[model samples]
Target: MMMRSKKIKLLSLAILSIGLSQNALAEDHWKLFLKNAYIDRDFDNDAVKDTGSWSQAISLFYDSKFQDTPIDQLQIGLDANVQYAVRLSNDKHAADSVLPFDAQSQKQASDYAKFGGAVKLKYKENVLKVGEIWSDSPVANIDASRQLVGTYLGGTLSSTVNDHLSLELGVLSKYSARNDDQFRKLSYTQNGNKIQSDGMSYIDLKYRVNDQLKAAYSFAHLENIFNKHYVGLEHNYALNADTQLNSKVRYFNVQDTGSIAAIDSQNIGVIETVKYKNHTVAAGVQKIVGDAFPALDGYIPELYFVNWNVTGFFKKNEQTYHFIYGYNFKDYVPGLNALVKYSYGEKIKLADGIENNESELNLIGAYNFQHDYLKGMGLQYLFAKYDTKYGNDFDENRFFVTYTKKF
Candidate 1:
């Protein structure tokens, strides 16, 4: 049975790291922190006929703490992570190719790579975690846009019951949709060699109703026959001091519970099949300048709403809209940045048949160099255009350079 569930998740992470090192040796207060990151990407598409590929990644993180703990009343911790990826080009396009395939003319070098680890146990507002993490739910996150590293084994619980509420719950296993291995269920096939059943489950909520409003909600249950729901709302105001007025709205719903007869026989010969309810809506607005903007500092930068692999651009009843404006040059170039964005969406078919609509435009420019010979260097440029009524129209361009250091 999956090797006794991997020896009971490695004996429960070695008994939670020996009970957090015996509670930091009976309260001598210990702490540790380490982080590392690296990434690379390249892609292109002319309606997928080949000419796109490149990937690389490395990551590591570990955190530990035990600040005076007896049975919880303040601090206690353990967080761990380890990740790796290498697939530097081998070109074999078209397996749902949205561009990027040619890893050395199909001889496929690198041959995919992955390893994962996770452990979390905290006590000052509860937290208990387990192996193979990384599923920032909103319908499956952790797709750092390629370079592999997608994980999920199971067990998660987070809590914060005061000062504006928070809660999260999870259960996972059966995820290998391209990498970050570990699967004994959750099936999806198409060249990773067809296998099925990865029933998913999730619950999340966040609320903070002061200091400019906030809200979030979610529920998921895929593989017990798909049922998903999410709702979000955010608002911030300060239309002065360099302008600020952020707003956000989101909603999504999906349903189907005929108990999977092969997902009702592949939606019955798909022509964009419908009969299992779907609805999605998104809203966005961003404008900021000076004194801030490191990817807009923390929320709502609208690259299709906080990357759950580019958050659904209209695909339920279908509707989407986004707009962005940015400029930061306090002294002409301290971390130079500029941006322009526009998006439009449409896709409707309430029990009919064919008709797909989509429109998009994006342009971005970035530069962040704190000159010490390029401190944590980063430079980027991107352009995108897509138009569709039924077919034929595409344009995408991207170039990025990134570097980091931490030890």
Candidate 2:
């Protein structure tokens, strides 16, 4: 613990110094962000640990671009950021949390800092970045649903092949997800061998079929760990100026490579939404094939249309369904919206031939201030309940407030 603390202090000091120098160099423009998050949770009698946390984070960023004289079409840029977070007083008892700490989350649950710098180059429609950077594609995304933003150390490239097609490529080596402090090699944590240089390479392509239809595919190879392929299709149909219909379908196939072939899984899902005036209604369903939808992810968001609030219905042979209703109060009260969702999953296979069922209900209300000084401010409240036949039951409440301003 002492050695880790010292490392954090050293990194923090170095980053602070570099950030101060950068702020001086970019006197006219620099970015600052402050964020705070709190989670309040109640568990069933069987749960013995606390499930609450409070975290506060701050970050400073500087980015600049210049065109080289010799290469008129080439542009070079530098991007740097320093970020730090501290556990708030409200979460002092989180040391005994319901879930055991992962290496990254353990470090982030205290006062810790991270520094990142990236060099970017652009030629025509192609852009490349090397070193520390951030990317949030659907299949591979940084975990930013918490106090701190997720970051990666490696290289990535994006290019527009033509008017109808685009491509993305990445070779990421290390990253620190939202709750983690120290960056670790990007890999699946559930592996028996805890630490492996699990470098990942991926390529994604998007093609536009027309003004209302689009399709995309992404492929990833996690060195000796796993392989994943995802394909998605989306279409929009206009019923009228005030009414429309949208549909999306996504499919995922994953398999383990190397010595471990346990992560094999497949998921197929579709979602449809109808909008009329200020009201929107949506419904979706997902089917798990092969084994369970294995959680082979760095930071897994519900890429599927049916996965909602609590769990993603990622159990063996499970099927999930969800419905969401949203109302936009913009017609009467601008910048106000509310959503209610219900999700259910069943048909989960157990080792002893039993079946498990799970469900969740979520209520959310959000408001964005539009006044002069508070124009960028926002407030939100969310209440959720999760029930399961096989695992612990829980309820959660969250409140969020945010504001951004440029100097």
Candidate 3:
């Protein structure tokens, strides 16, 4: 604890020094974001009781360019965040608490902070960076759904090989979860057991076949655990001036590798969406083969299946169907929009050979204030109902008020 505190202080001092040295310049390159959120979750299963919390978070980001310096193509980036959450209610089930509980203290955790930065070198159309980073690759990604976003520590290189093709490669050595203040080795969890790995590596490629068609492929490996491959195709078609149609086909294959052979799965999905003026509608189907989709311990993988909501909807032998409806109220009420989604999964085969089903309904609404005083402020509300045939049923509600400012 003492060592961690010292490191935090040192990082703070370094940031302060940088700001003071370039006071005037830094102002133009810095941004600040603030958010206040309240989340409530209720479970029907007594084993996992209800939980609620109110949280506040602030994030700072800085980007500096070496314009006329010797390293003119180099840039420095810094990001840091502080978050505190207070428990509003619990069902007195510390053993099964869904809140942010500290196992050692047997109580809820209230404070979290992280600091990280990166150095970037730009060469022509290619860039290389090393340090803390976030990715949105289908095979490996960071979850930004919570109050804080996840981060990985390592190096990444992105190259624009040609007008039609682009490539990205990276190696991650450590990970900090959305709620964690410290980084740790990457790991996989199954049945409450965690298997730690040295790191993860990945390669991603994208090609533009035409103006409206694109294809992507990604390969990822979690050291000593599993290898994953993702292939996807996307297409867009303009029906008319005010109408557009989009479609996607995505597939994934996973296999156990190295000494720790513990994973085997395949996932595939297809989706079609059409947007006409203010209304949007979509539908999709997805399936899981062999086993369940495995995530990196507590981290959420970028499962881009159409049926993926709060859950991946990928259990052993599960087949899911999904639909969505959305409306843009900008014509009637500026800066307002809402969407509702539903997903149903059936034929989920548990280890005991019992077949079950699960479903989820989600609704989300948001409004961004257009007034000058609240120009950068937004309000959002989200509600979800998750039900299963033989598992815990739950409902979730989240509300957030956010503001972003650049100095």
Best TM-score among the predictions, by candidate number: 3
* Model 2 Cα RMSD, 1 decimal: 3.5
Could you estimate the TM-score for every candidate? 0.28, 0.88, 0.91
Better of 1 and 3 by TM-score: 3
Clash pairs detected, candidate 3 = none
lDDT of 1: 0.49
How would you encode candidate 1's per-residue C-alpha lDDT over 1-407 as one tens digit per residue?
46435644654564466446555456332222111222222233354553344545444444555445666465545555433333455544432222223445643333333444555667778876777667676655654443344455777888998899898888776554343344456543322344344657788888999988888887867664556566677777655554455556655445545543222111000001111111112334222111111111011112324211122343334444455455556366777666565666555332356646666676667787898986776776666666666555556665556565533
Model 1 segments more than 4 A misplaced: 1-51, 54-109, 122-125, 128-142, 150-157, 162-164, 167-205, 208-283, 295-407
Tens-digit lDDT string for candidate 2 (266-330): 88888899999999999999888877765544454544434645556777888889999999999
Off by over 4 Å in 2: 1-30, 90-108, 189-197, 297-299, 302-308
Write down the RMSD of all candidates, one decimal each.
23.8, 3.5, 3.0
Better of 2 and 3 by TM-score: 3
The Cα error of candidate 3 at residue 75, in Å, is 6.3
Q: Measure candidate 3: CA RMSD.
A: 3.0
